[model samples]
Target: MTFAAITGWGAAMPPNVLSNADLSTFLDTNDEWITSRTGMKERRISHVGATEMATLAAKRALACAGVDAKDVDLIVFGSCSPDEQVPNSASGVQVAIGATRAASMDLNTACTSFLYSLSTANAMIRTGVVRTAIVIGVEHISPYMDWGNRNVAVLFGDGCAAVVVQATDKEEGLLGEQLGCVADARHTLRVRGMGSGYTNSGVMLGDTEWDFDGQEIFKRAVQGMVQASQAVMQKCGVTPDDIDLVVPHQANLRIIEAVVQRAGLPMDKVMLTVQRYGNMSAATVPVALNDALVEGRVKPGALILMPAFGAGLTMCSHLVRWGDRVTPIATIPDEMPASKLSALDLVNKIRDRKSQSHEASHDGLQGARLIGAK
Candidate 1:
């Protein structure tokens, strides 16, 4: 039977680190408070667009596979922060990497994007549609971030990661997965002033407002992830003891701990990036996956578990069997362009632009103070 194997992985993380101290400059939050609540110390702020990060990650992933971009059959860019809605972000990576013959498309289920993209590519490859594919999970959340909203402002960071999947007869790659969404709770986490609904509504494009019901989101996220993890494991006929490593979404340290406890998985077996990168929305899981391999946690023929929740209240879990290789065949030397501004400066600049763009809502957009009240 044909299966899709993960052959290579790469991550493109930004250089500028936004510390909790930097957030304290404008809000009431400090390192101790933020860390205790979310298990986050710092997160990256990108100077470049999402596609630029995506392109660099794609190049590294292709090089790691020892497969030239020209030979790639598909490029699946999973992200919510597209550079432009018309051209599509996947096409940007395709052009940048010169994947001349590859079919490219974008996929977004928010935080579950990478896993969903992996499942999509795996199905296509297994069905004999595409042979080699690059799947990416990336986000540039800083631009539209409501920097004054302490609730969410401290939880997100900018990052990108990609993995190469190819056809194999081996019993590796994704064995089973569970995907679902809670439409009823979707309203609990909505971003105002982003889509066509806010196009001409006295609100500028980047002047976003957030409706983040942390309490409700916490309950739903924990429940959804735990249930999905259990369902996927049951479907694959594997117990929590059979999972070698768990690479879960980095939303909150508390949420992760809860899911691990409820799913009967030990904390030591899970890979976490929330303490450093915060919740990068779609970038969390893939970045954590790459980090796990780098840390020598993944072994040949090992079973891996990945569970994630996203903005749509979308939830999913994937079970994968690792192949023999964990290290990359070749590591690309290319890096994302360096940033001139510090993390705080970059964030303040965004706030400056946002305030100037919408003077009427300037005070309201200061952070959660204004938006949360709305």
Candidate 2:
């Protein structure tokens, strides 16, 4: 039987650090309050586009696996914030990495996009549809972010990560997974004025209003993640004791604690990047996994559990068994373009641009209206 083995992994974090102190300059919250509530001290603001970050991550991942771009058969870009909606972001990465012969796809399941893309690639590789694949979990949320809203403003960051998965005879990679969604609670977390529902609804492109019920989302996220994790473990016939590491979505520190604890796992067994990076949406799990490997936390033949929830109210948990190798086979000398702007300045620029766009489109947007829906 063929199994998809994750042979390589890499992450690209932006250079700009948006500290809580910086946020406090404009918002009513301070570092201590933010830290106490969400466990966030600082987050990143990307000076580059989402595709560029994903490209850097992909190059590093391909080099780590010592696999040439020509040999790759597939590329899956998992992100909610794509650089372009039409051409698809995966194709951009494919071209950037020179993966000429590979097929490309973009997937969005909110924060669980990376895991879902991983699952997709794994299934294809196991089914003989592809031999090698690159799976990217990336998000560029800064542009669409509503800086005026303190509730959700301080909780997100921009980042990207990629992994190389190849066909293998050994029993490794994603063994079991449970994918689900609470559609009824979908309204709990939403970014209005972004999707097709608002296309002709007099909504400005950069003008967004978030429908976030924090307490309700907390309750649902924990319940969904815990249930999914338990279900996948049972499907794979593994107990909590068998899991060597837990790489979970970093939406909130409290939620992470509650989910792991409910699954009978200790905090030390989990890999956390929330305090430093906040929630990078789809990038959360893969970036945390990359950090774990870099920190020497992942061992040979290890068992890793990844659970995540996103805005579809989408939730999932995956069980991945590692192979013998934990170190990269090679390295790529790639980096992001230099940026002289501070994090606050970059954020303010985005805010100003958004404000300008809203102002310019004010009349036209007001005239636009939903045509089909009642």
Candidate 3:
């Protein structure tokens, strides 16, 4: 039987960091409060677009896998913040990397996007429809962020990571997965002014108002992830003790702890990045996976559990069995361009522009029935 193995992995993180102290300068929040509540000391603000970051990350992944761009047959771009909606972000990555022979598609399940993309590629590879694919989990959320609202604003950042998967005779990669969505609680974490539903409704683009019920989201996220984790492990006929590491969605420290605890896993086996990067939404799990590799935490022949939840109220857990190699075959010398602006400066500029263009119409969008509540 043919299996899909994760042969390459790379991450792109912006240089500009928006610290909690920086956030306190504008929002009615402090470092202690933000850190204690969300375990976020800082988050990245991208100087470039999401597409650029994804492309750079893909190149690195390709190099790591020692695979040429021409050999890739599929490219899956996973993100909620696309540089453009019409052309699709996957095509942009394909073009940037000169993967002229690959079929490009976009996938978004908010924070669970990467896991979903991984599953999609895994199935296609196993079915012999494709040989090599690049699955990217990326988010450039700073531009679309509702900076005026500390509730959501402080909880997200910008990042990207891509993994190269290829068909192999070895039974590695995704062994089992569970995917579900809590539609009833979807409105608890809605971002207004993003979709066509709000077009020409006096809701300016990038002028967003979040309808976030933190308590409700927290409760649902934990419950959904735990259930998915349990089911995926059971399906694979393995207990939590069989897993070597847990790389969970870094939405919040509390949520991660709650899910792991309920799954009967220990904290030492968990890989965490929330304190540094917050929630990069779709980018969270993949970036954490990359970090674990760099830290030498992912051993050869290890079994890894990834559980994540996203904005759709979407939830998923993936069971991955590692191959004999944990190190990259090659390395790419590419990196994101340096930023001239500080993270705080970038955020302030976005806030200022949004305030100027959207302040008057903000009320209309904020109170819209379709978005539920502000």
Candidate 4:
């Protein structure tokens, strides 16, 4: 069996941060209440675009992997906040990063997206179909959030993270995985808009409303993740004691604590980033993975368990072994062009085409009016 190693990893959060106090100015909530509940004092916001954030993340990951964009064979993007309804987000990323030769696509299993992408990438690598792959988890949750309502409004932020997975002959790296979904509870948490189910009926015409069941989602998230984690641990033939690190999704501190307790793992073994960056949806896992690597918390041959749970009633866990042999990529020069060609540029190009079409339609209407007058 071909081993899949995480050769590189990187994350990107927007410069502008929305603090709890800032949220209170717009929504009816105080800093103490928000922090005590979610342990998120601030979260990143992407003013440019979700595609921009995702591209930035992919660039960094590619750099860390010591690989050029041209070297990537596949691109799998997991996202809940896609910039467009058509033309999958991964296509935009592939063009943005200059991975012209790579096959690209997107997947959405709510917050479990990154794990889902990892699983897919691992399978492709094991099947001897691809050598180098990039898996990114990005979210622009601010767009889907209901600012008027404090319940769900304060729980999200924008960010993106990417990991470079490469095929190796080593035995370590991505040892086991477990994925589960509760379709009957899909409606427990969701943003009902801009999809085929809503758009085909014209019910979501220009509407961007986010409907959620906060209590139910919170309960399910805790229970589902704990169960998934246990199953993954068993599959890997290891107990909680054998785990060197537990990187649960950065949804809420409370949820993380609950999962740790249920798993009978020490709190110190778990990594937390929600305080610095709020629930970044699918980006949460990769962000934490990058942080752990930077902090020297992960060591070669260490066993790491990553469990992610999200809005689709989705829960996934990946058991990965830290391998010693990893390629190190050189850093990009500081003088690199600021006007970088990116996926966001590609999106703007598409938008420009749409605008030209509208203008042409208007000109045609004017010509018809002139003929009628004559």
C-alpha RMSD by candidate, in order: 5.5, 5.2, 5.6, 7.8
Write one digit per residue (lDDT tens) for candidate 4, span 1-374. 68998988877776666788777765789989989999999887665456667777888888888888998999998988777556677887888789978999898988989999999999999889998999999887664555667888788877888999999999867888989997788887867654767756644322446778877887888888888889989987999989999988988899899888987899899989999888999999999888888888888788999988887799888899988733346544322123233323322332343334335334321111111122
**Model 2 residue 321 lDDT?**
96
Which portions of model 1 miss their true places by more than 4 Å? 358-374
Model 4 local distance difference test score: 0.78
Arranged by lDDT with the best first, the candidates are: 3, 2, 1, 4
TM-score of each model, paired residue for residue? 0.95, 0.95, 0.95, 0.87
State how far residue 235 of model 3 sits from its true place (Å). Answer: 0.2
The per-residue C-alpha lDDT of model 3 at residue 232 equals: 98
Query: Which regions of candidate 4 are displaced past 4 Å?
Result: 200-206, 325-328, 333-374
lDDT (CA) per prediction: 0.89, 0.90, 0.91, 0.78
**CA shift at 252, candidate 1, in angstroms?**
0.5
lDDT value, candidate 1, whole model = 0.89
Query: In candidate 3, how many clashes are counted?
Result: 0
Model 2 spans > 4 angstroms off: 358-374
Output the TM-score of candidate 4.
Answer: 0.87
